[model samples]
Target chain A: MQYIKIPLVLAAVLILVIVFRNRQRVELRAGSRVLVLALAAIAIVSIIDPDIPQAIANLLGVTRGTDLLLYLLIVVFVLTSLGLYFRLRDTDQHLRRLVRSLAIDDAIRKDGPPRSDADLGPDSQST
Target chain B: MESGPTRRNDDVWVIVPCYNEGPVVRGVLERVREHFPHVVAVDDGSRDNSASEIAAAGARLVQHPVNMGAGAAYQTGIEFALRDPEAQIFVTFDADGQHRVEDVMAMVDHLRKSDVDVLIGSRFLGTVDGMSMSRRALLRAAVVFERMTTGIALTDAHQGLRVFRRSFARVLDLKAHDMSWASEFLTRMSEHQTSYEEYPVHVLYTDYSRAKGQRSINSVNIGVDVLINKLLRGR
Candidate 1:
């Protein structure tokens, strides 16, 4: 019963992911899918062979498998936080680029005259 | 500064893509208004007063109700420029003030004389004074990566300061919604066999721009997207 519970939960999660993917509103990338599959596979393997959890716990200097699960969750959370940080940084860069583009376009729109070619230095010329 | 030969006015449309740039949007728009008469600012669903500020600056504004990626905003601006009969050339300028107003003329001149469809700005071509060493190195690495991946020789592959002729701009199917759009643009140019040039330009990295700079990890995300686009999207 204990072994069956892990696979059953994983199967449920997989089904849910598939259903969400089929809706097409939010499609997971192949890399993300692979990550999810790997996670599920690890969960299944740990369930089928109870010794795996004990080994992980011993490796981590923990006495209980539950402690191992807790450590794993903490690691996952840390990674998720790192991912979010990167995402926000990307958003900030995109915003700045957009703002700069708008500013230059605005400048050109207000001034009707073409800039003199002499204004641009020789080094500025396109190759 | 020695001036190059002047080109016709009908050949270029300067595109500015903005998002929530309420404070400085007015100034940037005003500058564009003064220099490039044919300017289009695509408001990428700015949550603030960006769209209104752009409209107030006397430039044509294309508003996206929600914030799409910079790539989407550029595509919107390009579509607007392509619709105009006078827009024979399209230039992508940032809403921030990193790119100089004078550099646009140089790019346009190069595009007009050379048998090329695209002109990119290269900060490394000449002396780069105001940029940080870290940024300079990172940008150089990105350029090398792009050259290896796309087989296009460019001094600055990711610079936003670029000019494209109508013939090349019209055929581009730029689908990337994020910063990877820059790479996607290069990939499209390579696929279409569009002629291109790299022009040297000054990149002013102000405190504001530095604060808004992307972390190095985002480059990894962009790299992943590039690989996916090339391998999966088959671009």
Candidate 2:
């Protein structure tokens, strides 16, 4: 192992141990953490042994190892951006429901509720 | 012929989703209340005095604290109306005064007399007072898209004036929180096997309405949103 890899790998392993021990419910966060750690490990390993990524890249018909990493970075960036977008959409939906209920509750409080079904029509009376 | 109880206007709830159209909303609600007394104007975080305008028009106001889109506003209004065990019909009207209350009256009458569960007001089937070429083209393209995707033949797809019975509103379950909700509504209508028909109604475009209405370019955002939503939903 290279001089820089020694401390970096040890730190990564320690962080992974703590994360694995702490994660139980938040599967999304845990999965993302694992993916980030895996990527970081690969990056550190590539720095330590430049020929490994180059050999893999050559086998895959790529001329350079850094080019392979670039392509992967593009893919990972797109995936992460899309994941954030979907989460934002879900959070927005929840916010809408919360605001909607609050609006309805306040309206009922101020307006004294909608008129009863007796005088309106047969529809509500039947229900 | 059997005698069925004629539906009254008090049972219909007109859900006017107002954003910043403070100037014209009160006038529209006034005309709407002339025919249908129970009008619920949903104020979608308008910076203007639309809430007071709604109150001034004698319509009940349900207000969003933050600026949710028109779809969210309409959904809030629908939910608020649904609370009243008395509400039997739900009408989604624009607050910018493009929609005519006369058309609402006619559509409500048609829905009551017929077996249709939803009456969608179509400008193509009726008349347009003033329409730009690009606006008309965009609307036509949206119709074609709806036709190909949902296989639901409609002359107009994104018209804001829609009247549906309370029974349909109860199970609407709209997911889109923005203008994309229009397409989502059509999508769900097919899934629900709703008995729907298009009614010819006049749509008049004014300077204020044009300024306040959505840009046709937002259709691109709506398309992406719908596609991504479908993909994420895995349906």
Candidate 3:
């Protein structure tokens, strides 16, 4: 009966995630998808064999399963941070290209020829 | 065959794409007139007095009714320049006074001597001063990434100061509305096997230039644009 409950919960969560994935604004990246799967596995394993949580808690010198959950939350937060970092890096590259193109466009529109430092006054001269 | 001086006159049309640059538009026009006699400035629907300033400066003006991206403006300028029979080379100049006039000459010389179809300005080639450290780092990373993706070992892949031969420019199908046009250009150039040269050019990073800049956060939006255009739109 106990093993049956674990599989049932796992199936329910998987269906819920699939349904929500389509509607959610923040779609999961490949890394996040892997993390989520790993988490789901852990959740299912915990339900099927509750002693696993107690064993992890003991390994970490924690007294309760809730303490183990707290550690897992920290791990999740770290993974999310890593995901955000990669996303931001991708954004930075995109912006650099945009600025370069815009700058060139602005220059081209004004019928301006390319300018040297001598044109911008001596103070504005690039070193 | 005509002499070297006469042959030089047969090539090169300066293409300028202008937006809301009312203040310094006149200066840019005067500079181009002094150096390259044939210059065309395309006004990309500036809400400001950029168009009038361009006309007053006495350069041919191609106007777009609504504000389009730089890539669109460049395309317009190229189309107009292509109409001229004397224009054998089409050079893209920035209106913001960042690129050097001498670089255009150098690019022309390089294209004429070499078998390359396009010559791009590279700030990282020889010496680059007055660039912010953060900007330099960002640009270096982008150059590496672009080189990796396109297999083109260019020092400065995104520099807008480019000189394209009339023949190559005519065949290019540049349809990018926004900044992704630079990447698109590289992708196309590689696909078409267009020979290109990367020449060193100066980059002047002024307070005004940086102030009238896009926010760093907009990079995410640009990345999304690239992914969508490349994958979803099948471009």
Candidate 4:
């Protein structure tokens, strides 16, 4: 138990530091900031008294505190990463659209307006 | 025989998104032009001579610099049409020569008479010749999935031929940039409460079209895309 406490506390502190550093690059919303704080508080409490997480896990049907924390952390990490992945994909799509639109605009300008056949008598075939 | 009164050809825009279909797209454009002269073909960065063929066919051509996907091409065409006040009806047609012009005419006719916002061509309701048994099963599964997610029981949820009124077209800002757009379109239709009707339409599944159509395994990817879209939109 003593050996596990040192590693767990170190890991929790490392996560906090990484998250703090990430905050400089990404502006954490109020809800996310509160969530991070709560997670940090839980980590600190669990490191101080390892039995607390174990008791809660026993109540929740999970056997071990480490196992429960690991499960929740994996789930949250997966969901958050998925969310960020989707956001990055969407931004890429928008950027691609912007570039495509620019290319289309250039083509349209060079070829002239893509008017309907009814509007084009003889000049529309120039493109 | 004429079914009902249809809108004038001048007011409608036939949007065909062509990608590496240089061989057949011109023929499709010509057939569509016979009925509706207002045609726009968005060439999705085809390395082939599709742009030249589409331009030669006399359809209005919008060239994307790279392959942006069919949904993006449709968005470009719809946006282009909406820029003009004269464009009333927007019909999304395929470049693979599968969709029939008569079906589009009938859909436009229905749109003109009914108060519906859009008309979707249902191959299940009509004839879909040469469709493999596995493909049919896949399509049926897709219909069931779409029904479960969108609460809209469509006979052919993945059909490419859809006619949208200018108003409804303006309302539908499509987000999906791939084959998933077909499924996402239904979700949006449900989300916007867009009044839609399914019309029977013949689909000629030629060897070329079957080869070009979506593979059965891609259906799972489409389902995931729809789920992600719903999640991202917080719906």
Which candidate gets the maximum DockQ versus the true structure? 2
lDDT score of residue B171 within candidate 4: 76
Q: For residues B170-216, could you state the per-residue lDDT of candidate 2 as single tens digits?
A: 88877788898888888778878999999999998998888877898
The interface RMSD values of the models, given in order, are 9.8, 7.4, 12.6, 7.0
Better of 3 and 4 by DockQ: 4
Q: Against the hidden true structure, what lDDT does model 3 obtain?
A: 0.70
Tens digits of per-residue lDDT, candidate 1, B3-79, equal 23223344568889887778788888788656665677888878889888987887677666567688878887786
Model 2 agreement with the true structure over A5-121: per-residue lDDT tens digits: 899979966654454344334875778888999999998999999998999899998999889988889868876775666567778889889999999999888776766443234
Reference-based lDDT, residue B182, model 2 = 86
Best by lDDT: 2
lDDT of 4 by residue, B22-95 (tens): 99999999888777767889998999999999988988888888888888888888877776577889999999
Candidate 1 ranges beyond 4 A from true positions: A1-127, B1-8
Cα displacement (angstroms), candidate 3, residue A82, comes to 28
Kindly give the stretch of ten consecutive residues in candidate 4 chain B with the minimal lDDT sum: B1-10
DockQ values, each candidate: 0.05, 0.27, 0.04, 0.17
TM-score of chain A of each: 0.49, 0.62, 0.51, 0.54
lDDT per residue for candidate 3 within A1-127, as digits (tens), equals 6689898989966654453333223454554577689999999999999999999999878999888898789867865674565466446446534544564555546544333222232343332
C-alpha lDDT of residue A52 in model 4? 97
Question: In CAPRI terms, where does candidate 2 land?
Answer: acceptable
Alpha-carbon RMSD, candidate 4: 8.0
Tens digit per residue, CA lDDT, model 3, B1-235: 1233322433567878888888888788877766665677878878899988988886777677666677877877776666555568888898877777777877787788898898888888856657778777777776776786567778886788898887788777566666767777787787789988788888776676676655556555656665544442321
Candidate 4 per-residue lDDT, tens place, A24-81, comes to 3434556577888998999899899999999999999898888899999996796588
| Cα-based TM-score, every candidate | 0.64, 0.84, 0.62, 0.77
